[model samples]
Target: MTVVMVEEIDPSSADAGVPAHFGDPVKEQRLLETAVGLVDRSNRDVLAVPGDERASWLHTLTTQHLSGISADQGSELLVLSPHGHVEQHAFVTDDGTTAWLDTEPGAGAGLLKYLEMMRFFTRVEPRDATSEIAVLSLVGPAAAELLPELAEPRIGAVPGPKFAAGSVPPEATAIYSVRPFEGGLARRVPLGVDLLVPRAAKTSVIEKLGVPRAGLSAYEAIRVAARVPRLGHETDHKTLPAEADFMAAAVHLDKGCYRGQETVARVHHLGRPPRRLVLLHLDGIATDHPPAQGTPVELDGRAVGFVGTGVRHHELGMIALAVLKRNVADDARLTVGESTAAIDV
Candidate 1:
């Protein structure tokens, strides 16, 4: 049987907007936890870097140590400003010739421009590949079983930059699969693979996969519960990698000189980041909508932080991610709008 598609599907997805759910949000969440769940991430932007020097070029641009990233390997990179503030975030995988990058919506243009401006004498060429490719995230207990090679590769899960290409739709030239890291909050969420396929073959591939399609409503709730920080939500131009807890995953402390290396080193060695990410447990007794993003978080009437993404977790009730002052105690009582909340670092 073929997987059914929504009749009036929104291609741009502007009609449904974010947090759009198909079925019961809780049920969809459970689907991701127990079985396979498919999430259409076409709303995300993609950039393709094609050239002989793509890997070395990007290696010097971002914090990840890309020299070790051979074929079928990948890494998450953070583009920082000269002051060591996170300006962009992307997951990168290289196919020897082309470096494929997946970034948050509306962030591709800026990244492309930055890459172009700094292309003094490098042989790399970066182009927007959003129209050429589409992204689908498959997650659940069965995900590894569905894509065995991606989960358990023969060479012992190539450490540096893990990526693989496989057959999907005939029209789709390649299916790039990335394995999620097993650390941090990822340990609490279901392990999965992120598939990047040709734009024209997205529907065919999804239908052939025969999995329930989950929407942002289910994804956002689980993302908050897992304490995973997104680009637009928990990060901005002023956010630093260390402050977002991305130091271990995205930044390299011992790498050669990069644009923001000075600031990163200074912050890491002596100065502490003023703000840090925390999970907020919102008071469920409130009869109104949970605190919106950017809501002020106060400690005993003094503003201490700002709320990021707030969602109703199926099991955890109303919870949110917040960027709070480092001085704030982990058990501090916080007030958001007319509601009360507790902090978890």
Candidate 2:
């Protein structure tokens, strides 16, 4: 497994398939904002839920409303503990017979097992498809525009999240799916497209696209700017989806019953969440390494929250994403390690 760390990444470039950047991150960020940038998400794990009742059964298990989802439509799904604490989160889409769930690295096993345990009498059999599939992403405001340019699937018309099925030309049809979503990077970038291809064609497909590569640093900067909360990075063992503001993208309020729906709904509609995920622009970040994940965040010398993903942005300077006490003033000057922090409201 490849471990993504601030210290391990080089701002300049790295070996292919590594999370680090290639050449210049500032330019990569620019590409991500204006044109399009290539990102290797093969490290992400893909799980398949195949069966006659996959959609309805899996719908009842995840936070997203999947019972009525049509083929090629994409939605972010969250698996929460009984108390509404987030346990696993994945980017999900279907191809009529099966639902493909792509989640953070090394998290597919637990998610699959949980599905198995819940299948008391259901007709769903979850399979780990990571070995057979690979994920690549094309991001930027012009990402959707490049689909036809690259001779890829024209996944258009249907707004929100969509998955259009396509293939790698010249034969071989092992599930080439394209999912274009907005929340992956941010609103600044119009859309982000994820390509799921046969593992054997991953290399050939990327070369055919012929775009500049963006590393995890650039990806992190834009993600933080967009306030996209990752599971392990943003949430601990007890993180409620509302605390990270995930309900907007990951939860369906009137979709009927699901695990953890009570707490997710109560906090989002009836009551205020005790914590909030906020953007932090820091004064002092290491020249080579951003603050480590789980670094303490304080306000008035009192511990408030912990740091999540941190990076030096192309335009935002030293920035990070943190979840803080809801009561903390938006204008309050907070501290993280030796750096002074201000909330981006």
Q: Give the TM-scores of the predictions, in the order they appear.
A: 0.83, 0.83
**Candidate 2 lDDT, 232-286, residue by residue in tens:** 8899998998788676566665566789988876776545688889999898753
State in Å the error of residue 216, model 2: 1.9
Instruction: State the lDDT of candidate 1 residue by residue for 1-345, as single tens digits.
Output: 222232233354331323356746678888877787887767788999988888778878887666556556666788888888899888776666778888888889999999998888999889999898776777777877766756332111211222122211111012234443321001112336677777887778878888887876677776777777877678766888877767655676666688898888777766577899999888877644667778888999999888888878777888889898888888777888778899865
The CA-based lDDT of model 2 is what?
Answer: 0.72
Note the residue pairs that clash in candidate 1: 72-163, 73-161, 73-162, 74-161, 74-162
What TM-score does candidate 1 get on C-alpha atoms?
A: 0.83
Q: Tell me how far the alpha carbon of residue 316 in candidate 2 is from the true structure, in angstroms, after superposition.
A: 0.9
